[model samples]
Target: MTVILKKVPESEKYILRNFCSLYLHELSNFTMNLDVGEDGIFHYVELDNFWTVDGLSPYFIQLGGDIIGFILLLERPFLNKSNDYGINDFFILNKYKGKGLAFQAVEKLFKEKQGQYFVIQVAENRRAIAFWKKVYNRLNIETHERQDIIDDELCLIQTFKI
Candidate 1:
């Protein structure tokens, strides 16, 4: 089954904001980089930039009209600049894991915007590192992995050309 990537409309901006809070919460387990505001919500300061900034895209990952996750695509990522495209954020709900949807979604995005692409993970996120490795293997794409400090935190960066 092909998972669809739908461009998020401005009208549905709130939906993306809500989902990003959840995504950030999950990432907190690994990076400890995010926290809830006094308002009792996790606020993503960059979420609004997708609508106003150049070289950014927001998409909802769908399975037959059901929105299961979201991905934020970048033309020139803030964290890494060498690659032509970067994944600022990507998430598939826990229930959707181990079912190949993530692989399918990444495959579709990478193919649609074929070029030098990169993905970054918090250095301690071993699960994320393994997941990306499998994705690369399944796609059979050559990759380069290295370590760098981004935002003052150590991160694992992987780059590839499609």
Candidate 2:
């Protein structure tokens, strides 16, 4: 039942790549008709730059000793506000869903990286919107929400200072 966010090591780039492909595949179901590519891989050309990017971090969500998912964080200020961070990508394997594991993992992630945080869910994904609302309620933090068009798709943005 131990959930941990382990920083993805450079030596394990393949691990992250594999997980990213899976994450993208899952997201495609809820996203705006995203293509998973001919080879069924979501190629992120910028993944190699994660190590060098100043505020970007990629972490593996490890439950016990197994890698179950990943979260990509961006530590950039939002709307000129300092110390604002973004949860760019988060995913828990389909096999691991409906088990309260994501809540534990996200709670730990927020506790360790406390600051102004922003989370975005695709407007089409009702389940994700509901899940985030529950998470925020469990955390007992007040949040401001708005809808915005990002990358040609409308997204539900939640902002909270933790």
Candidate 3:
């Protein structure tokens, strides 16, 4: 499985939008309810800003030329703190989960975008928390975990310097 990150092109923006809906649908099972419009669009605000914003990067996680996931990275620091790159969104399709593909994709992402990294996972998403922990541990990097309240929802935040 050759996992690669390809920058999403403007012409393929719809692909990301569709994937965002899928990601949101999966997240809704662990987090708060989301109102995806009748057209099944989720994260419209962020989607709009991502296209116009300079610091935002949206990548398609491709496995041998097939897109199986998406990752959204914010070049800016988390909460405006210096040196932190925010992992705004990460999702692997259910059919591709638990195969170490996410680890490979994230490792490539970190190598390509090196900086202090911050990732937030819904407190209720035990799988996500465990996945990040395992990834950091495998890399032998020290990570700091904390609880934070974002948008009035408690979340698990993991920060690491790589």
> Which prediction has more favorable lDDT, 1 or 3?
1
Clashing residue pairs, backbone N/CA/C < 3 A, model 2? none
Across residues 1-162, which tens digit of lDDT does each residue of candidate 3 receive?
A: 779999998889988888998898888888665767876566645786677878788999999899999998888722376555888899999999999999999999888877788899989889998999899889887988899988767899888887
Off by over 4 Å in 2: 76-83
Worst lDDT window (10 residues) for model 1? 75-84
Rank all candidate structures by their TM-score, best first, as comma-separated numbers.
Answer: 1, 3, 2
Lowest-sum lDDT 10-residue window in model 3: 75-84
User: Which lDDT value does model 2 have at 138?
Assistant: 89
lDDT of 1 by residue, 1-162 (tens): 789999999999999998988888888887767888888788988899998988889999999898889999988544355678888789998899889998889989987898888899998878788999999988898999899999777899888999
In candidate 1, which residue ranges exceed 4 Å CA deviation? Answer: 76-81
Model 3: number of backbone collisions: 0
Please, what's the RMSD in Å of model 2? 1.9
Tens-place lDDT digits, model 2, residues 1-162: 879999998899899998888877777777665776778698766788778877788899998889999888888532345546888888899899889999988999988988888899999888788889999898898999999998788899998998
Which numbered prediction scores highest in lDDT against the true structure? Answer: 1
Candidate lDDT values, in order: 0.88, 0.85, 0.85
Candidate 3 or 1, higher TM-score: 1
Order of quality (lDDT): 1, 3, 2
